[model samples]
Target: MTALTLENFLPYRLSIASNAVSDAVASAYRALFGLKIPEWRLVTILAEGGAMSQQALCGRTRMDKVTVSRAAIALSERGLISRASNPGDQRSHLLTLSKAGWELYEEVAPKALELERQVFAGFSDAERQLLREMLDRIETAVERLEAKG
Candidate 1:
């Protein structure tokens, strides 16, 4: 039988590392902009992808619908994002960053990138690329497994 240990498990280690990075990013965003992880994710995605539906945001971010909905409601209340009628689906509205949100994003983006650099400061450019590729491969493998089920 194969020996199993949580500490040595690939998924466990990945989750731990991911949480550490997310915590660091979340703390900085909260301190600088009073935004949580979900809210920041929405802002970043909207800034990059332009207006999109909540469902699309969920698919892009891989975040659950409830989390996305709460973030959208919070951002809308703060006047950081606006909701417009979706042409194809009247029941759903498209979300976009407001002028204020864009201004905040402009300030936040550089800081976020700098924080990412800090997190991976010891890694070489090649190592970073490899890390990205490895993550993509893991995701692809997971998709295949899920599709088989």
Candidate 2:
């Protein structure tokens, strides 16, 4: 077979790297708080943004409706979050982190940041910035291309 070229190699490399990073981050967070990735993401968004609707949570987390619904229900049941009728929209309820949730977030957020630092431990600040910029550009380009099709 012919050797792989840059065009074929880069996408595979990026995908592998992304998967590895995601797995590592998920494992670290799970060990820290017994939180699955989706749960952790839900908590983080609620903590940062305060109340939101289920649909809004899905949008913020980039998660599917089913996943967001499940997580929200679990969180509510655990007393880590609360849901109430949206006065403006009866069809959609509002969700918010509870006192327990905020307390957990306060405890976890710093550790999560540290974990992120460890994950990128080898990269210099400049390298990290460049990587983020490149990824953003690529994502924007891909989104535009997708929109056209």
Candidate 3:
């Protein structure tokens, strides 16, 4: 067998770690609040931003338009959110958290934080900081490359 290199090993390890964390968080959110990853993302964005258009939400959550639209409709049906016409744009609607949505966010945010903390519990503060910095650098480099093309 050939020797392993950082280029190959790093991506494999990161993918494994990402999948594990994603699975754990998805399971926790589903069990605790019956929310899927996309739904949770929409709720989190609405909670933080108050109100935003679906296009803006897609950008903020890094989710596809269909997923965001479906989640928005589901949340609105559940009485957790409301969609209204965007004053500036006739084609897009703005999404906002309803009272129920805010309540749900309040209920689930702590649990989500706890889940994330437990997931990263093995990492020390310094390690976590370093990991974050490194990840940010990698993201920036990738974005720069994409921008050039």
Among all candidates shown, the one with the greatest TM-score: 1
Q: TM-score for all predictions? A: 0.97, 0.86, 0.90
Greater-lDDT candidate between 1 and 2: 1
- lDDT score of residue 64 within candidate 3: 93
The deviation in Å at residue 55 for candidate 2 is: 1.1
lDDT score, residue 62, model 1? 95
TM for candidate 3 is 0.90
Q: Compared with the true structure, what per-residue lDDT tens digits does model 3 show for residues 1-149? A: 98988657977888888889889989988998888888999999999988899999998877899999899988888999988899999998889999999999999999998987987899999999999999999878877998999
Q: Which window of ten consecutive residues has the lowest lDDT sum in model 3?
A: 5-14
Q: Write the per-residue lDDT of candidate 1 for residues 21-113, one digit (tens) a residue.
A: 999999999998999999999999999999999999999999999999999999999999999999999999999999999998999999999
Candidate 3, RMSD to the unseen true structure = 2.4
**What is the alpha-carbon lDDT for the whole of candidate 1?**
0.97
In candidate 3, stretches whose alpha carbon ends up further than 4 angstroms from where it belongs are 1-7
Ordered by lDDT, highest first, the candidates read 1, 3, 2
Query: How well does candidate 1 match the true structure in TM-score terms?
Result: 0.97
Model 2 Cα RMSD, Å? 2.6
Residue-wise lDDT of candidate 2 within 1-149, one digit each (tens)? 98987657977889888889789878887888777788889999988898899899887777899999888887888899988899989999999898999988998899888978998899999999999999999888977998999
Candidates' RMSD to native? 0.8, 2.6, 2.4
